[model samples]
Structures are given as structure tokens and as C-alpha cells.
Target: MFSVSIKASSIPMSEREPIQSSMQISRTTGQGGEACLLLTGSCTLSALGRRMGDLSDELASYASDPNLHWDLTKIDQMDDVGAVLLWRSWGGSRPEYLSIRPDQERLFSRLGKAPPLPSLPAREPLWIAVRIGGGAILLWEHLTSIVILAGQLLLDMKYLIAHPARIPWREISANLFRTGAQALGITALVGFLIGVVLSYLSSKQLQMFGADIFIINILGMSIIRELGPMLAAILVAGRSGSSMTAQLGVMRVNEELDALTVMGIPHSLRLVLPKVIGLGIAMPLVVMWTSAIALMGGMVVAELQLGLSYQFFLHNLPDAVPLANLWLGLSKGVVCGMIIALIACHFGLRIKSDTESLGIGTTNSVVTAITVVIIIDAIFAVIFSDVGIR
Candidate 1:
């Protein structure tokens, strides 16, 4: 009898290991006078996936023969993975001439009757209306909380006014000193630099029109009426407001706020009101201080750039910018400071009891305070436009 050779080299070199699990396929005469594929050896999940290429590479040679058959009588072992692989090779159906044991036939018949794999659900498109509605709900909640906090603060203030002895003067004093005295240096430096730059730029433009004297008016009106208070508010928001929020948040994390409540202490009156009243009292003074320093800075630049005397600048400043503008700026400081303190305390109280909450509360307090300050400044500009214009 002549023997035919089957080579593992027929598969890719990556699967050429002689010791690995493998399959043998050979062309042989079938019962109906056609060539068919002979599958033999152990066909199982353990080896079928790794030896897939060895069988798939030669499957096409006997596929078109009308009498093609599967002779699996020599298969020592079989599994679902091997059964499915052979089923697919036969165009996902059983061959009429399949010669196998009762168990293998039952396995192929069960696999054929199994339902198709479920398809994945399609993805849905995003809806803008849902997103907008959710955002609106969140914004409404925040605004309502702020309004309620403001009302509580007003009630506390009215009570303090009626009973002065019950007020927490010591806490107020400490916060004032911390937020005001400690902040003076940076506020002065920033105000001075701003004034100098404003004067320098104004001198260049005014000199073109022989309007050098008007630089005093420009610098005075801009600094005292707008820049001074806005600058001070922003600086304090970033510095003092963040600290307040962090302090309260830390207290919350440590459960000191709850302890205070247990001892019959009102957190709003002791913690929140003190900060609010302190900042409201200190802010106007800080604004005036910043404005004076900035004006001095403007005077120095004027003297050097336009040969304008300090006396002329001082004398003209009062006439150029009215006392009403100074009052407007001071009022802005009071409103802005109260808002900042309240907002800081509000966020601080909302903090979750954790280190991450402390940091997030402080950052949110600073950002919200600064944004509110600018928005209030704009509203003041619109309402009092005719009052402060020189």
C-alpha cells in the first residue's frame, strides 16, 4: 500500500511546533466517488483554537464536491469548540454523509438547534432638552439656598442690633484683623502699580491733545470710583474668602459644627455673622486705603511724565472726582464684602466631611465670591451711572 504524507509546514510557521496539539487532514475517496476531507485525532477546546489554521487551510479543497463527507470515526475526543469549528467549515450545517458516533451526532444536532447569539442594543442619541432642564434645576437650587442664607443672616443682624451684648465681638475683631491688616501690603502694591500704569498711558494720550492736566481727572475718577473697590474686593475674595471657607469646612470635617449645635450654639450667629459683619465693616476702610495709595502712585507718575506737581494733582483730584463717587465706591465695598462672606460661609457649610470637600469648598468660595463681586459692580454701574460720572 502506498502511503500519503501530511505536512505541518502547510500551516504558518508560528504553529509548526511538533509537540503541540494538532489535527491531520487528508484527501480520500468518499462513498459516492468524490474526494473528501478526513478529520482525525483529539478535537477539543484545549487544542482547536491553537490549531485552527492547520484545518482551515485545507478545508476549501473538498468544499465544492457534491458528495463531500466528514469521516470523524477516528476522532478520539471532541468538544463544543471543535464541533462548532467543524460545523462552520461545512457551511454552518451538518453533512448528509457524516460518519460519527452517537454522542458526536447528538452534539452537532444540539448545536444546530441552539438559538443565534443575542445582538447588542443600539446606542441612543443625546437630548439637549434633558441636559438644559437638569442644569436649570441645579441653578435654581443654588440660588434658593443663597437667598435663604441671606434671610437668616438678616434676622441674625436684626437680633444683634437689638441685643448688642450678645454679639460675638471677639470673633468679629479677629476676622477683621486677619482679612484687613494682613492683606494691606498686597493691596497697596497692586493698587500702586495699577495707578502708575494708568497714569503713564493717560499721559501719552493727553500729551497729544495738550491735555496733560486732565490726567489727574482720569486717574482720580477711575481709581476712586471703580478700580479701587473692585480690586480690593477681588483680592479679598481670593485671600480672605478662601480662608473662611477652608476654616469652616475643616470645622465641619472635624464635626465641631455639630458639637456647637449640641451645646445650644447657633452656627450662623457665631460663625457666619461674625465674618459677615467684620468684612462689611472692614471693606470700606480697605477700599479707601487702596484708593489713596493708587492716587499717590498716579501722582508720582504724573510728576515724572507730565511735570504735574503733587499739589496740583491733590487739589484737582477733589474737583475732578466728587465725594459722591467715593461714597458709591464705599457702598460697593460693603455690599460686595457681605456677599462674599455669606457665599463663603454658605459653601463651607455645604461641604461634605472630608479633605477633598474642604479644598473644593474653598476653591468654589473664592471663584463664586469674585464672580459675584464683578456682577454686582456691573449692576451698580447701571443703577448709579448718573450719580458718579464726573
Candidate 2:
């Protein structure tokens, strides 16, 4: 059997005023050679009166013992703080041989039932199959939305055909100016540079064989049939497609589209149909203008580098390049314009009610329009490889 005693500096109830109280802690050996702590006097904030450093240190030494017991029968008064101190000394749980009055037992019971502190959520890595499946689902959702938008536009077109007066001619003209007329300067500038570079390079190779006159054939066929339509389409996709998406996205964010719906305005007819038709009408004209300007540039380079007269270049250009190639390029222009407008409207309608969504929708609209244009151009090349080539 062993023993340890701790005395506090507080005045005991009997030694001072009746309201004054003090605490004391003592240790003893229990049955079966276990260690025990006996808590006596008032075990409360006001009663303990001073910090129980000595008592806590005395108890801490026996913390590693598995058979430690606490006897709380002699506690005359206790509050939450006092209960918490003793509860912590017992490793936050009751010991096997604890002895406490019914009132003190209730204090410890409430502490034990308190909700635990919150912890951070665990981060788990996703399986490879789950990631791939999720991506496939998202791709399907986007494709379905695009198809629905196209069907709505088609229905609106039929309605307009029956009711010609309800057609939005004013909107169509405005979009034509924005998407096509405004883009002419950049398209012409790029086309002229492309023509000059192609002529210069072709002159170098044709001159080696003393066949400099064939620069007209190579330059006319390449620019009118392929480069002209492609340049116009790509420029429109970057400049005008992104604008359409941003405009619709802002309308969605501001709830303007909802207001239009409430006012009995069909969104597809008012917003999407005019833009598509306008671009379709304007794109062919842009292609023709770009091709004309590029041919003039090629003629200038041929006159300067190949010592070929402008008159000879012009007179032979029509005979050297077939008319079918010109028609093919204009046809590509009309199709590409409708495609760009459709892709823009598709992403625009998907924007959420936030500025971040507006930016993301615009970026996606431009990228997807350009990608579709290249894919379609490739398909056109493969299918018409024999038709336009001489």
C-alpha cells in the first residue's frame, strides 16, 4: 500500500466564514494492488478558490496506470469546470472503480454526451473507369442540347415561311453588318498576304523549269478553291461567333430571356433565327470579295517577280481555273456560316447565372465553331477531290 497527500492554500469552511470552501486531494492503494485518488472538500470554481496545480500534478503521475480509480463521495459542491477537471484527469472517461454521488454522476453524464468537434472531409481518388464514364455522359448531354436547338430553329423557319410579315428583317440586316461587313477589312488583308506569299514561292519553283507562266494556274486554283473560303470562315468564327455567345450569355445572366418569354416572344424566332439567316446570306459575299482581292494581289506579285503583265495574268486566270471551284468555295461559305451561328447559340443557352459562366461559354463557342469548320472542310476535300480538280 502507498499514499500521497496534497493540500491547497484555500481557507476551509470550518476555519473561515461558512461560505468559504477549500479542496484537498490524496492518494491510496486500493484492493487488488490498484491505485486510487480520493477527492474531498468542495470541488468547484468558487470553493477550490485557487488553481489546483498541486492536486492536478499529483494525479497526473498515475495517468499511465490501467487500474486507477476516483472517489468523489466527499465532494460537497461541484460545477462544470470542477467536473471537467476531474473528468480530464480520468482520461475523459469514468474509471472501473469510480465512486460518485448521483448528482455528480449527472454532471459527467452530460459531458460525455456532447457532440464531438468537427473534422475535415476525407479526399479519395476516383477510379479510372468512373472518370471516363462521367466524361462520356457530359459529352452526350452537350450533343443532345445542340440537336434540340437545331430542331427549334427549323420549326421557327417553317413558321416564318407561312407568315412572311412576321420575319425579323431588321434583326437579320443588323447581324449581317456585324458578322460580315465588319469582318471584310481583316479578311481582305490576310487574303492579300496569303496571295503574295503563294505567288512569290510558286515563281521560285516555276522559274527553275522556265515555266513561270504556270504561277497563274497554281495560285488561282489554290486560293479560290480552298484558302478563300477557309480564311473567311475561321475569321468569322473567332470574331462573330464569340460575340453572339457573349450577348446571349449576358441576356441569360440578366434574366432578359425570361422576360422575353413572359412577353410572348419566341426566343428562337427573335434571337437565333435572324442571326443564322443573316450569316448565311453574308458569308457567300464575303468569300467572293476575299477571293477577288487575293487574285488581284497574286497578279501584282506575278507582274513584279515573274515579269508577267497584269493583263496576261487576268486574261488567263479564268481559263486556267475552272468555274466549278468558285461555286464549291461559295457553297462551303454558306454552310460554315450557319454552323458557326448554331454552335454559338448552343453554348450561349447553356450559360449559368454568373459572369464566370459567360466567359467560359464564349470561349467554348469560338473553339467548337473553329473545330467543326476544320472537320467539315476536311470532309468536303475528300468528297469533292475529283469534281473541282483539273
Candidate 3:
């Protein structure tokens, strides 16, 4: 005979019982006869409390058996909760050979009753629609503010032109130097790489067609007509536009703008005009620098890969790209810079008296500037295509 035994300790009546209780199980097997379970003492609420581990161990021993015979003959006391725990441990469904003492029949009956399950509330389609509609309204309001600001900028152009002296020259110069000169090194490196890539790619395709010499024309046209203006504008917009929005937003939140107005000072002339003029002057110069560096990069690539002389590359550049193309790039840079400054100022002025509004204004400036740049580029593309510039 093989047997295992476990004993549970008594729990206190005055104090609350622990969440789990211990139990002892004695198993006996004799001469290969069906294994027998001897469950003793009370695994009850008042006695053993909740002895889940003991019950689980007892059930696990009989898991591989085809038929389990439980001997509850010596149980002094049992409760409905204990009966339910046993029933759950034994695979839930009633076994055909379950043996319960006559005294514990009431406990078994209670365990058979099912507890009420929680009910889930039904979802309402109207509530979902209302939330979606509210979000749409908020988006529309933001878009409307952007449109009104653009309209106001257009109407103020005549006023700006007439009062050119009202623009703060010193502040404009400071901002131009900060936004343009500080970015020169990185812009030159990026422009150089772009030029090198264009030269190498064009050289390969041109060599295949026996037109390798025209690689200069390809680099010149691509840089002067498109890459130089677009790249410089994007870099300035990302750097200067965010800074302008953040600066104005801080002023708006701290009530400095209001204070300036109360002191009879023109906030627009002091703040907005300087930024607009600064960017307008700086952007074209940045574009010119970017174009020069890009051409140098292309010249280096041409010399290394296409066996072309640096002097030859420089000599062919003027004929390959016209002065008209350089002018077009400069005009694009000016327009893009004005758009970035205008959008940044407009969003900044819209900030509320909170940090959240400041963040929103800064983000809105970048998005608006980039969108305007793309739209203007598309317009230029259509115009240039019609004129047969390519």
C-alpha cells in the first residue's frame, strides 16, 4: 500500500481567517485495487477555512485515474463553500461515483447552485456619433482660424510697404544673423552631399547614352531650379518658424504683448515686422549660398568620377544654367520665407494663457509653413512647365 497524508490546522473564530487554508490528504493503494481517497476532519468555514492548496493537491493525485472514489465518512463538519471548492477542483461536472455522507447532502446541494454573473451594459450608437461630431467641429474651428489669419496678412501688405521704416532694422538684422549664419555649416554639408549624389547618378546614365558631358547641365538645372530653393526654405522654416512661434507664444502667455499695447507701442511693428523682413532678406541669401556649395560638390564629384577638370566644371555651369533660373530660385526663397514668418506669427498670436497652447502654436507653425511651401512649389512647377523651362 502507498499512502500520502496532509493535515489542516484549526483557524480562529474571533479573527478573520487567511485567504488560503492548508490541508492534509491520505491516499492508499492496495494490490492494484482502485485507488481510495480518505478525506478527514472539516475543510469548512469555521474549521480549516479556505484550504485551496490541500484540495488542489488531493485532486491532482487522482487526475490520471479513470474513476475517483472519495471517502468523506470521517468528516466531522463541512460547509457549502468548502463543498463548492471541492466540486470545482474535481473538473466541475458531477462524477457518476461521487460519495458524500448523508450529513453533508445539504452542503452539496448549496454548491450545486450557480452564482449570478455580472451583466455588461449595451453600447449606444448616438453617443459615438456625438463624440465624432464634436471632434470634427473643433478641427473646423482650427482650420477657420488659419484661413482668417492668411486673409489678414494679405490685407496688411499695403500697410507694411507704406511703413517700411516702422520695421525694426536692428532686431531684423539680429534675427537674420541668428537664423541664417548659425545654420550655414549644416546646410553646406547637406547641399554638398545632394550635389555629389546628383552628379554621380547623372554621370552613370549620361555615360550609358554617350552624353557624359551633359552631366554638368543636369546638376546645374536641378540645383538652381529646384533643390537649392526648396532645401533652404525647408531648413529655415523648421528652424526659424518654430523659434518665432515659441517666442511669441511665451510673450502672449506672460501678458507682455498686452502690456506693450497698453503702453501705446505697436506690437506688430516691433515683433512681426522685424521677423518678416529678417526672413525675407536672409532666405534668398541662404539659397544663394546653398546653390554655390551644391555646385562645388557637383564639381568635386565630376572631377573624381567623370575625369572632368574643376575649371571645366565651373566654365560650363554658366551656360548650362541661366541667370533667369537663379532669379527664379531667389524669388521662391523670398516667398517661402514670408509664408513661414507669417504662419509662425499668426499661430503664435493665437496662443492662449497656457503652456499647451504654446506647444500647439509651435507645431501648427511647422505644419502650416511646410504645407504652404509645397503648395507654392506646385504652383511654380505648373508655371515653369507652361513656359517650357525644362
Best by TM-score: 2
Mind giving the per-residue lDDT tens digits that candidate 2 earns over 27-76? Answer: 88777677787877777777765567665665666555667777787766
Tens-place lDDT digits, model 3, residues 1-390: 111121222334443344333334677653458676767666676565455667566675564464756776556456776676677776665555556765466557666676657788767779889889988997788678767765655555566678876546788899889778887887798899999888888888888888878988888888988999988888888989999999999998899999999998666667876788788888898999998899888888888888999888888888888778888888999988877887788888888989988888899889889888989988998887644254
Worst 10 residues of 3 by lDDT: 1-10
As a whole number from 0 to 100, the lDDT of residue 237 in candidate 1 is: 94
Cα-based TM-score, every candidate = 0.68, 0.69, 0.63
Residue by residue across 1-390, what tens digits does model 1's lDDT show?
A: 111112222235566344435567766987678666687765776666566765655564455465777788666556787787777777777777778866677779899899999999754355577678878997798789989988988899899899999999999999899888888999999999999999999999999999999998899889998999999999999989998998889899899999999999899999999999899988988899999999989999999999999998898878888889999999999999889999999998999998887887788889989999999999999999899674
Which scores higher on lDDT, 1 or 3?
1
Q: Which stretches of candidate 2 lie over 4 Å from their true place?
A: 1-124
